[model samples]
Target: MNKVSQILVGGALGLSILTAASAADPKPQDTVDYRKSVYTIIGWNFAPIGAMMKGEVPFDAAAVVRHAQYVEMMSKAAPEGFTKGSGPDAVKDTEAKPEIWTNWDKFEAKMNDFQQEAAKLTEVAKGGNEGAIKAQFGKTAETCKACHKAFRKD
Candidate 1:
């Protein structure tokens, strides 16, 4: 009915889907598919915020908060997507590099950074302070760049 209610409902549905995916004995390809879908959803919610932040689109605090919520949720959801045996070698269609499985600790640290920054971005967005939101967005984007640089392939 309301925006908050919609977010909660949507998030609950996403969590349920994630739970279902993890509960089953997924094939390697299936795991890859799941992770790809997760990232796609993250990118979907993330692009508009990025455009707004870059001044390519008008800044709307309400839109920023909504997008930040999805980004934060997906950042938390992302770890599950990087399961063992789902790397590019196994999947063949992912941009995920071998270092993800080989240098797991470092990759995990980057992921943690992303999750923390994403959460912080959501909090900053809720405050309706453009400067703080922009700063947090930069921090969150840095985490993404760090992770992508270390673990993802071009």
Candidate 2:
């Protein structure tokens, strides 16, 4: 199969496993914790690429590729954290808005957008072109912002 198909299959499998785990876990807190952990890893890996793109740090093609890989992986891993019972009503501390569940289709679309853009970013980063990587980063960040605006709280 092609790389995109492979990633889609892997992501689907990962999501199912996570959904099962969420179902098995006894508390909403467990799901919340899992969600938090996944996002933390994503943000952690995503920051340096933004720094490089912004000129806060010298551009490093290798580092961009490395960070992009993690971002892409975490994007795939993200679905596991958003199972049904993990919303604001169940876990008061989460920044995830209730609409994530209420508007599940929209939220899922945003998540898919993120996953696709992140995958594209990883592939573009591999090319080692700063300009192209920067553009891809913007696209990925736009997906994040769209999701956050519609589904997350400040």
Candidate 3:
């Protein structure tokens, strides 16, 4: 083939491979694991912040802001983790309820609530005011509980 034709063919082949890879469905276990990891990241950051807010531990301003930021970042990616086949019925041992799929609009609204509240909490934490962070922290935590109450199971 001529040089231009060869370039076009190579680019088309690369594009096809990329498209196929992106379109391939994830395995059920992989979906479960990914969703778990995303939640774990949120929980890991949230624990210390909750402790600080509740005075169960001495309030560390830096840690509060740090962890809040982590939650905010992870929250942005949280929804995508709940892919089409990642619901409870798709896999064993998942705490996510089938209601998440059935009541998807409600479930999604709750998820968005967390995203917004987490963002607010992130801003509050950055301000480093214990009072504001404490108040917003409660709001943020409530969002989690709301979603859990509706979607998550024991």
> Which numbered prediction scores highest in TM-score against the true structure?
2
Error of 3 at 26 (Å): 1.7
How much RMSD separates candidate 1 from the native structure?
7.5
Question: Could you tell me which residue pairs clash in candidate 3?
Answer: none
33-116: candidate 3 lDDT, tens digit per residue: 767888899999999988887889998888988999999998898777787787767788799898888889999999999999
Relative to the unseen true structure, what is the Cα RMSD of model 2? 9.1
- Once fitted onto the true fold, the runs of candidate 1 whose alpha carbons sit more than 4 angstroms away are 1-23
TM-score of 2: 0.83
Candidate 3 Cα errors over 4 Å, as ranges: 1-24
CA deviation > 4 Å runs, candidate 2:
1-23
The count of backbone overlaps in candidate 2 is 0
Q: Report the alpha-carbon TM-score of model 3 versus the true structure.
A: 0.81
Model 3 is weakest, by summed lDDT over 10 consecutive residues, at 14-23
TM-score of each: 0.82, 0.83, 0.81
Point to the candidate with the largest lDDT. 2
Better of 2 and 3 by lDDT: 2
RMSD of each: 7.5, 9.1, 7.6
C-alpha lDDT (0 to 100) for residue 89 of candidate 2: 86
